[model samples]
Target: MHRHSDAEPDWDSLRERIIGLGEHSIHKSYYPELQDRLAELERFRALLDQTSDAIFLIDAETGLLIDTNESAWLQLGYNRERLMRIPFCNLIAPASLAWFLEFFASGQNRARREQVTVAGLMTADGCEVPVEITIRFVTFGDERYAVAVARDISERIRTERELRIKESAFESSTNGILIADLEGLLIYANPALLRMFDYEGVHRIQEKSITDLFSCADTDTRLLARLYREGAFAGEGHGRRNGGSVFDVHLSGSIVRNDSGQPLCIVGICMDITERKQMEELKREAYEQLRKNIEQFAILGDHIRNPLQVIVGIAEMIDDPLTAKILNQSERINDIITELDRGWVESESVRRYLKRRERPEASFAKIFRNQNNPE
Candidate 1:
């Protein structure tokens, strides 16, 4: 029971003031922190919306869409409110619906926690859009949901189809086609290449150096060097078969390059030219025989004329009746020689024309000139 003075402060009032200050401080600090959390949530939502992949959160038990990202509504050409009202299963195209229903109903997705599938999604225009969907089961609090991330795969499918067409063309070509690495090791040989080399299978030719197929020891190196310098090569060479037999081949090759012009591999096309080479050899032989015949005709005409001239000179000097008959015979013989000479000239003209048409290497002009000059 202490006595109170007017100057003494009120204990109850001070306690009330202290409590009010604490409450005010708490309110001031709490609001800013709350605002920061809300801002962070907004940024996260924006990030999810920015991605190209369509993301959806579905109610696992009801098979209904709980929520979806911006891409989902945009891709399906639906407003957010309308898309949210639709069941997730309704979005799948008819062709893929059965598989999806089985996948969900079998409880396999729950057991695996994650699954991947390719399915078509129905668009607003009733067109099916191919998508690669990755589904993951997750729990938030007591609610179970399926998180699906879908990526469009139309471009990938198109590219695969084009690749198949190109492969088919390569397989069906008549000329031999081969692909080799930068080191000149064979990697792929088409069917025609295998048959041309008399190989039972592609495995026989694969891993073998490209030079092994050619009789020339330096063909591979030369061709590779040329490809690096000029980007292409084309020429004729002898090809060695599996049984060690050789045949003529015309090979055309180029460096397979990337879009950036960097060399990736080598591609070659080969043609068997054995028949053409044989034809050329036959022509050369025929021309050689023709040249010999022409030479013999010219020589025979000269030999016969020399004797005929001597006989004519002796008959003219004798001045007898038999001499006059001999002269007449000589005239006949001279006419025959002139006709033979004309024939030789005609044959020589024909020979010249044929020589112009033949290859430069097949020329026999020097041989004929040497034989005639006897130098």
Candidate 2:
């Protein structure tokens, strides 16, 4: 190789040329140290670029972005050159402009160290994005800078909003809702639940186990077992109120499970069905009485029909008009009694007539005479 005695140095190519001098050059020791410094700076920049959070180096005095990482470019939807030219405050939403000013004004004398602030970022499309920002003042040579690490918290904000809505619905529901752990300890009960059990406050209900609310503790255990196996249970049962009075209730519940399908808790709703149960009982009793009345009507009709048949047969042997009319009316009365036995007439009215203090046969005679006379 030929060596040049003198050559004008290419300033842009100095880094490569200095490193190439290697061990044989007079400046070898200092050049290697310089190379190490450059390598450290490059590694530091790479670390910032690889970070998931957006990183920005801002000039504290001028409020301008000195440098930014790849995440900052992607988050703000802006290129590096544009971000560096714009003031850092321009990227904040109008609502958060005063807050940013205050943060920057604190400068090195910041009251809080490494405090996280929630703020909004305005993107290229003029959309505001929620972010959590941690900021600290860093000194580099003669200048002070604010280094910011911002994490997008849009999903977290949305999740919190949904949770608030569900909590509101749970508190405001009209039906009695109860949540209990696997051990049957009551974890939560809504206002309606407290009132349903005639309790004045939630603390009173909280002190009682779920089994204590039910009329039968054994049935409650069986229901809990079914809920564990099937993930849900719905049925009617008797619930004891605050005064120890039992009332019918329709309870529906389902097991709340974790992602692994392990049961976490049980949530249930109760509806008062005492009036409905009483009405059902009344209907059953009425039907039973109707059945017994029908049977009695049949037996009484048979007893009267046999004697009436003999009277009508004897009257038929006489040729007199009055006797013939009596025989005809008696046969018609026998037919009416048969119709009652067949349920062709409303049984309630017949039962009332039979149960009356006045003679039922007198009413029957009156009806037969009116049918025969027709006048």
Candidate 3:
């Protein structure tokens, strides 16, 4: 099928007919059509004026802005009449203008199609405003014009910068950081987290569930409920590393939610506390040993004191010089026994005091040394 050329229509006959009707139809149809066309132009102007984005219609051949929306004047801090003569490059930054000119001179291939880019737009006050611009080429009558839309994206740029900083902090942190989806499967893990779990790479851990990280029974269920309800959960847990080795871990986690308050993911940090847990167990064992030693000393002291008391009583009954000597010797022996008993009591008291005060290591050492040296 052959497509017809878009040629101008023949309006001479129509005009002649209107004149032959004694100008009556001129007021009826011609004036009304003119009014309708004018009204349509007014509507188009309103659409451009009401839009929030700055719009500029530029001459493609000369690169001069021929028309602009009201927002363009407000956004660029320029008067409506003065901006009509402003070249499009005047709105671009000095440094950016060079590249803009180079690209524009490369013909309208890129401009003919829809394109979006980010650039700095020079404001009237000489300061630059970063804007996201979209441009397209269009033809009106016999002339070509580039229609450009520019939007201020300061807030978007600021948010993206903050996101980059946060991501850097997360990546460089020493503590293990991991993020898991609502289903509890791992989505992301930092280097620290991968090392903590003894995994060579994050790919090995992804698609794994939180249950794989813990040795405690029912940890996933309990933690999930707590995190979703309270939005945070923190405490000690048995974290299983690679090769099935279970180690003590202090896990801190919180729930992440979307704007609508729906659960999105869980973010958590983990620290290995295996050495600290081992130290506590050792201290407990030492404390128990110290208590047993004190009890044994008390028992031995009781048995020895009873025997010494009997000897003292027998010696007191004698009256001769030899017997007096025996009494004196027996009294000396009793005095020595009393000192031993006192020493034992003093050591036991010191052990009890230290232990009660939570100095288990000190109490254990003191008791052990006293038993060996009897002081």
Q: TM-score of each candidate? A: 0.74, 0.76, 0.73
- What is the C-alpha local distance difference test score of candidate 2? 0.78
State, as a TM-score between 0 and 1, how close model 2 is to the true structure: 0.76
Give the alpha carbon lDDT tens digit for every residue of 176-259 in model 1.
999999888899999999999999998889998778887654344555665567777667777889999988888878899999
Q: Which candidate achieves the best TM-score against the true structure?
A: 2
lDDT of 3 at 75: 84
lDDT of 2 by residue, 257-293 (tens): 8999888988999878788778767766886788687
| Per-candidate total of colliding backbone pairs | 0, 0, 0
Query: Model 2: runs farther than 4 Å from truth?
Result: 1-27, 30-44, 112-115, 200-203, 344-375
Candidates arranged by lDDT, highest first? 1, 3, 2
- Which predicted model would earn the best lDDT? 1
Report the C-alpha lDDT of model 3 over 223-312, residue by residue, as the tens digit.
Answer: 666566668766777788888888888777888888998878899998887887798788778767867776776677678768777876
- The lDDT of each candidate is 0.83, 0.78, 0.78
Query: Model 1: number of clashes?
Result: 0
The order by descending TM-score is 2, 1, 3
Query: How much is the lDDT of residue 64 in candidate 3?
Result: 92
